[model samples]
Target: MNLDFLLCAIRELKRNKRRTLALFAGYAIAVSLLLVITAVTVFSKVHQTAVIGTTGTHFVTWLPSCGDLSSLTEEELAKLALGIIPEKCKQNCENCTGCNKKPKDILNEGFVINTNTTRLLTIDLANEINKLPGVRNASPFLMFRFRDPTDNKLFTVGGLFLGHLAVETNSCGTNEIIEGQYLSENSFNKVLVDDGYALNNGLKVGSKVIIAEEEFEVIGIAATGADPVKAEFYMLFSEAERVINRRIHNPLENEANIILVESVNGTVHGQVMEDVMKLMKNDSILTSGCYYPASKAIGLNEKLLWVFIVVILVSSILMTVKLQLSFVAERQRDVAILKAIGWSNSSVIKQMLSESFIISAIGCGTGVLISGLLLCVVPVEHLLGIEMSIGSPFNALSMVAVVMFSVFSGVFSGLIPVLFVLKKHPLEVLRRC
Candidate 1:
C-alpha cells in the first residue's frame, strides 16, 4: 500500500504497455457502460414517474353512484331516485307496502347521467380541495352530453364550466396550444378544440360552432395526443356552463365524472392518492379508478439497471481473472523468489492485489467521467422514453451507486486472483519457473 511499492507496480505495468493498455481499456469500457446504464435507469424512473403522476392528476375523477346534486351523502329513497335514478320509473315490490323485500341498493344500481346541475359545485369543490395539504392546483371543467346538431348523434365534449382558472402554461406537459391562441377565463363564447378533433370535424380556428344551442367562436387549436377523443374540445368555463344551460341541474353531478387534482411532486403521488381516497370515503363517495404514470415503466427501468449490473460484473470478473492469471504466469520467478526469501503469502497477495486496485481506480475513474459527459450530451428522454432533468437528488444518488459499484468490483476482482495465488506452493512454483 506504500507509494514506493505502488510506483514500482506502475513501472512494472508500464514495461508491458500493450498488455497494460488492454486491461485498462477493458475495465474502462465496462465501467463506462455500467455508469451510463445506472444513470439512465435512475433518470428514466424519476422522469416517467413524474409524467405519470401529472397525467393522473389531469384525468382524475370522482363519481357518485346515487347522483344526488349535493356533495353530501344521501340516505333516503326519494333523494336517491332524484339524484341518479333514471327518468323512467318501474314498480318494485320492495317499495310497496306489505312487501317484505328491501329496495335495491342504490350502490348496486348502475345509473349515471350527464347533468348540468353540478356545474357550480364542481368549481367550488375543486377550490376547496386545492386548499388542502399536498394539493397543487385544481380546476373545474364541465362535460356536456348532447347530440351534434349537424349529425344528430350523441356526442360528449368537456367544457371549462366556470371559475377564473386558466390552463396554466405547461399544465398538460406535452399537450398545449399548438396553433392560434388559448382561451382565457375572461373570454366568453369562444372555444378551443384539439387539433386532431378539429381535423376530424373539418373545423378550424375562427370558425363558428354550435353546441347544444349556444354558438361559440373558435379561438384556438390545441393538441393532446394522449387522448384523441377527450382532447377534442377546450372552452371557457362560462361557455361550457352556458352550452349545458346554467339553469339545468347538472345531470353529471350524481355521475360526478370530473375532478382532477395534482400533487406537487411525483413521489407524493401515493400520499396524495391516499388523502384523496380518504376524502372521498369520508364524503361517502366511491372512487371508481385512479391512474398514475405506468408503474411498468418504472419497473422496467429498474430491471434494466439490474441487468446492466449483472453484465458488468460478469464481464469485469472475466477480464480481471484473465489479467491476474497472466500476471501470475509472467511473474512466477519473482513470486517464487519472494516466497523463498520468507515473504509471507499475505504480503505477496497484497502486492498483486494492490496492482489490480491501482489499475482499477484509474479505469473506473475514467469510465465515470466519460459516463458523466455522455449523460450531459445525450437526450435521455429520447433514449429511455423518460424525461431526465439535471441536478435532481436522484441523479446524485445514481452517481454514488455507480462509484460504489466500481470500487466494489475492483476490490472483489482483485481478491479473487489473490486467493488463487495464495493457494500455490512456493516450491512447486519455483520448480516450474
Candidate 2:
C-alpha cells in the first residue's frame, strides 16, 4: 500500500525485462483473441439484424381449394394451380360452392387456411389486426383471379391470379429481382415477369404482356425460387385490382388472399397471432420463422464464440499463473531478506500483491494495445470473410470488466506462490538462500 512497497514491486518487474516482455506477449495474444471473437460475434448479429430489418414476416390464411374442378380441363386446372382460374371456370362456375366457401374452407393446391384458424384477407380485418397491442406490422396478401383475354380461352388456363406481397412490403420475399426493377406499390400496370416464366416465354423487360386482354408493359423481370411464382406473373395491388375489376366486373379491391402479421417480439408474436385468430370464426393456420429473418448463414457461430471465450479465459489464467509462479519462485530469497529486515508478513504480502497488480496491469495494457493494432491493421474480411465495424458492442461496463478480470487473474495467480513462500520461517528462508 505504501509508496516504498510500490517501488519495490516496480523494481522487481524492472529487473526481469525479458520475462516481463514474454508475459506481456502471452497476455497480448489472449486479449487479442478475445477481442477478435467478440468482434466476430457482434458482426454476425449485426449483419443478421440488418437483413432482418429489411425483411418481414409473411402470414396468410390458406387459399381455397379448387373444388368440383371436373368442369375445367386438366390444362385449365394446371393453370389454376398457379393462382388463376380459367374464365370458363369463372363464368361456368358462378354457382360453384367452392367460390362461395369461406377463406378458411379454401385450400387451392397448397394455399390453405386451417379450419381451426380465422381468415384475415380483408382491409378492415388487417387494419384491426395492425392496431393490436403486440403487432408490429400487418400487411395483407392481395390475390386476384382473372383469365388473359388475348390468350386462347379453351386450351389456356382461365385465370392468372397471384399474391406478390414481397415487393409490396419491400422485402426479398419469394422472389428476388435480378435484372430489372421491382414493381412499385403506388405504380399501376407495371408487371414483373418471373425469371423462369420469362425465359421460357421469351419475354423481356420491355415486352408488352397481355393480362385479361389488357396490355401491360413488362417493366421488370424478377427472379424466383418457389414453384408458385415461377409458373405465373405478378403485378402491384392497384394494377391487379384494376385488371380484375375492368375485366370481370368484380369489385375485388378490398379483398386479399390472406393477412400477414408480425408481432413486436417472439413471445408477443404468438399472443398477437392468437388475438387475430380469435377475430375470425373460421378455421386457419399459424406458422413461425417466416415472420422474422434468422441468421441462416452463421446460426452456430455465436455459440462457438462463447466456447472460444471460455477456453481463452482459462488458458490465459493458466498462462498468467505459470508466469507469476516462476517470477515469485525466483524471488524467494528476496522475501527472506525482507522478512529478516523486520518487514511484517502482511507488508511483504502487500508488496508482492502490488507487483502482481502491476504485472497484470502492464500485461493487460499490452494485450489491449496489440488487440487494437490487429483490429486496425488486419483485414477481417480477407481472413474470415465477415467485415467488422470499427465501433465495438462492448460498453463502458463490459470494457471495465475485461480489464478488471485481467488484473484479477494476475494478482490472484501471484498471491498463491507469494503466500506459500512467506509461510516458511525467515531463518529457514535465509538458510535456503
Candidate 3:
C-alpha cells in the first residue's frame, strides 16, 4: 500500500511537470547557495589559522646586554662608577655620582661582557632549548648594526643559520619571497634583502652589497610587510659573526643574543615558554601568539560573514515554507478526492512527503554536484589572498551536515502545509474548494 502511494505521488509529480520543475529549481538554488557559503566559511577558518600560525605561533627570547640601573643598589652603582662609565650611561645615569676614569679601565675591570653592541647569548643554549618537550624548533639569531664601509652609513643586518623551517619561514617565508630562493645551510656571505631595502639600494638577486667592509651576494628579495622581526639584510650566522668580529676586533664565536622558539602546537605553547623561562633568568621573552591590535578589522569582518550566513539560511527556509504552503493550497481539491476514495490521512500525508523527499533529494544532489564543480573552479588564493585550493577546505563531515540540513528544511517545509490540510475532513475540503 505504501509502495502504491509512493508510485502515485511520483505519477502526480510527472503529470505536474511545470510545478515540479518550479519546486525543484527553488530547492536547488537554495541548497546551492548554502553549500557555496559553507565552503567559503570553511576556507575563511583555514585562512585565519594559517595567518595566526605564520605570525603568532612562535616567540623570541633575548637577554638584555645591560642591567637596569634602577634595580641596582647605590653601593653597586658606586663601584661601577668608580671605573669608567659607558658612553650610554650619560642618558640613563642621572642619579649616579660623578666619576672620571680611562675607557680601558672598564674593559680591564671586566665590568661588562661584549660591550661592542652585543648582549651575548650562546648558540649552545639555543640548542638546549630545542631539546625541550613541545619545542618545535629553536634558532639562534644575531642582530647587528653594521656600518657601511664604503658610504659610512649604518645598516642593520640579521644573521641566522638556514635549514630550520619554522624560524627561517618566519623571517623570510616562502610566501614573502618575491624573487630568487631562500638561503641554504651553506650560504655564507650570501644575503636576503628586504624588498624596500633592495629597491632603495638598487639591489637584486646576484647583486653585491658591502656590509662591515665585506662584499656579500644578494641571493633573494623578501617583502615582509609590517613584520616585527625584520632587517635590511639577512645572512648566515657565521658570516654575521665575522662581520661583527672584524668591526670590533674581538672574536664573537658561537654567540647569539636572540633565540627564536616555535612550539609544536597551541596546547603546548605555554608549557614550552614556561620551560624556556626557567632556563634563562633575567631574559626577556616576546610571544607572537596574540593577534596584533590591527587585526580587529578582520575579526569584525568574520563576525559579519557569520551573521550573513545565518540570515541566508533563515530566509531560505522561510521561502521554502511559503512555497510549500501555496502548493498545498492549490492541490486541496485533489487531496479531497484522494481522501474520498478511502485513502487514509496517514497514507495521504506519507505520499505528499514522498513527493517532497524525491524533489529535495534530486535538488540537493544537483546542488552538491554544482557546488563541487564551483569549488574546483574557484581558487581560494584569489578570494582570500592566501594560497590554497577552494575545494580542499570542505571537510567531509561539514559537507554531510550541509546536505542533511538542506533535506531536513525541504521535508519540514512540505510537512507543515500537509499537516494543515489533513486537519480538515474530505467534505470540508471539498466545500472550501
Candidate topping lDDT: 3
For model 3, the superposed segments whose C-alpha errors exceed 4 Å read 41-59, 66-119, 122-137, 143-158, 165-184, 188-234, 239-255, 261-279, 283-290, 294-302, 374-388, 393-399
For model 1 the TM-score comes to: 0.61
On a 0 to 100 scale, what is the lDDT of residue 283 in model 2?
A: 39
Candidate 1 vs candidate 2, lDDT winner: 2
The parts of candidate 1 lying over 4 Å away from their true place are 15-18, 37-124, 131-137, 142-180, 185-189, 192-216, 221-235, 238-258, 262-278, 281-293, 370-403, 415-425
Q: What is the Å distance of residue 150 in model 1 from its true position?
A: 17
- Residues 335-412 of candidate 2: C-alpha lDDT, one tens digit per residue: 888988999889988998888777778878877777667766764443467554536444344345566666787788
Q: Number of the top candidate by TM-score?
A: 2
What's the candidate order when arranged by decreasing TM-score? Answer: 2, 3, 1
Instruction: Give per-residue CA lDDT, model 1, range 192-305, as digits (tens).
Output: 776866888788978888765678788788776543125356675556545554323332331223555655644455566677667554332222133434444545656776
TM-scores for candidates 1 onward, in order:
0.61, 0.70, 0.66
Select the stronger candidate by lDDT from 1 and 3: 3
Kindly give the stretch of ten consecutive residues in candidate 1 with the minimal lDDT sum.
93-102
* Model 1 CA lDDT for position 150: 67
Candidate with better TM-score, 2 vs 3:
2
Ranking by lDDT: 3, 2, 1
